[model samples]
Target: MPALLRIGRTLRRTLLQAIPTVLGIVILNFFLLQLAPGDAADVMAGEAGSATAESMAALRSRFGLDNPVLVQLGHYLNNLAHFSLGFSPRYGMPVADLIAQRLPGTLTLMAFALTIAILLGVILGSLMASFAGRIPDRLLSIFSLLFYSIPSFWIGLMLIVFFSVKLGWLPSGGAGTIGSRLTGLPAILDKARYMVLPATSLALFYVAIYARLTRASMLEVKNQDFVRTAYAKGLTPFGVTARHILRNALIPITTMAGMHIGGMLGGAVVVETVYSWPGLGRLAFEAVMGRDFTVLLGILLLSSLLVIIANAAVDIIHAWLDPRIGAR
Candidate 1:
């Protein structure tokens, strides 16, 4: 089959696979939130004071909490069908609107984090691979191991202390001062400065794994006949590796990186919460705590969609990078 035609077919298949995953996430999260102990109205009133039957009944009616679980779920599905996310009980706003408000901050944070992971991980991995079996390689290997095992929260605290307290360079904890918000280039840079520590800490885990993956893949690819053939033909080491080694080595790393992007974007709750960044993670955290089912379901569903879309992207990339893959 023609390469372009083959790629189209593969992409179609990939997107088709993603549909079921999206549905599954919606169904599962909705049910789990429903199954979670305590009724929604009760959760709302529990923190307020005593749960009078009349007041409780009123609260249930107010939120349509009187409906049977199945009916409520059916309504949810119907609302979802109409592309409506409904209002968040906690935020007293549409879940969709809340997501829109916070998504940019979350995206801004995750983009920097992804950038850090890719730059450092690829560079470190390439260096380690080039110097395989040497002191530099061993040291990097050990460092990657250590970085991978550390908890993000612990790393955040350490970064705050050593960088913020000891050196007095970065902020200790939080996104920024309330009134100091700026924009344009200077504002962006300043935000990045506040962002550097948490982004770095959040990225460390992915970087360690990706670096290891890259180093190993590159090292193995370097032994291939195509790479050696390029070298034997008097191509410069850099030229040969750039054209040959990295091309082949990037296949696995691309998959790993793409899949991780969704997690980093969606599952960044801990890092976001630790830094008090006003993003989806922190928002989702509050939603779950308050048993704001609408908000929680929306975030969970959005996260699941990200993961599915990410995987579809990875598959498309895989087919592009390695035409031999699923090329039948």
Candidate 2:
């Protein structure tokens, strides 16, 4: 009960700290949008083709563009308090609704990509650690470097060319079979099929980071006194390595995973665009291009919230894995 109470206190404190962080992000994003050149109203006007002064004024008033920046910020914050993200002038829908529509695709893609990264990274990192100073370790290091250095967009295009264009084994762009009505397992499989290339591209860079971090961490943990003690206590080599070395090394890997959430989201912008996948990243691209400030801010705030939550979760996991963390 005391431990649970401690965790509760930690969560409460973390949430209180997060409130100010979120407000600052909101304020900064609002001002940044204000500072950005080009008028959203003008963008709408141009798209409509030829606008008189009256029409322009009406457009500004309709979108609340006529309001002073401070008043607009106040209104935005007021709407946020009521669980509103404002309406998107570009999509002609509530920003929250537009985000809701795109959230599933982004979540799916990120889920697949992060899973691949974690699995492959842990495996490769273990291999490197087990084969330290051997050819296998060197080769894995080189492979990690290569993937880390390559741009995700380029990797995405290459995957599309090979898997979708040449082999025709998977989709080149977009989500699922275009215009085909699929349900149940068929729908899931179709979505996965379309997701392969983009997910792989997004995963590659993270894989590199995780592999390197894990390998270094494992090597360090392997030399620790606890690991030596485990081996001395009649534990099998595998047991000592797995229970002592790997488990201890995982603290750093867990930290990286938490940090990677943000990077993966940013990388999604490129991967989604390259593959024409209908995710938040692609929506963000369209929003920026159309000067859809509301949508853009909505995405930013949502992303920030996810990152904060992920970090808090990571801290809890860390405390669970090593009770010493709770003291810290």
Top-TM-score candidate index:
2
C-alpha lDDT of residue 52 in model 2 = 87
Model 1, 241-297: lDDT tens per residue?
788898899898888887787778655788887788889998888887787888888
Give the top-scoring candidate (lDDT).
2
Can you give the lDDT of residue 16 in candidate 2? 91
Model 2 residue 245 lDDT score? 87
C-alpha RMSD for every candidate: 2.1, 1.4
lDDT of 2 by residue, 217-285 (tens): 999998888887888899997888888888788998899899988888888998988988899998898
Which runs of model 1 end up more than 4 angstroms from their true locations?
1-7, 265-267
Runs with alpha carbons beyond 4 Å of true place in candidate 2 = 1-6
* lDDT (C-alpha) at residue 214 in model 2: 87
Per-model TM-score versus the true fold: 0.93, 0.96
CA lDDT, every model vs. true structure? 0.83, 0.90
lDDT of 1 at 239: 93
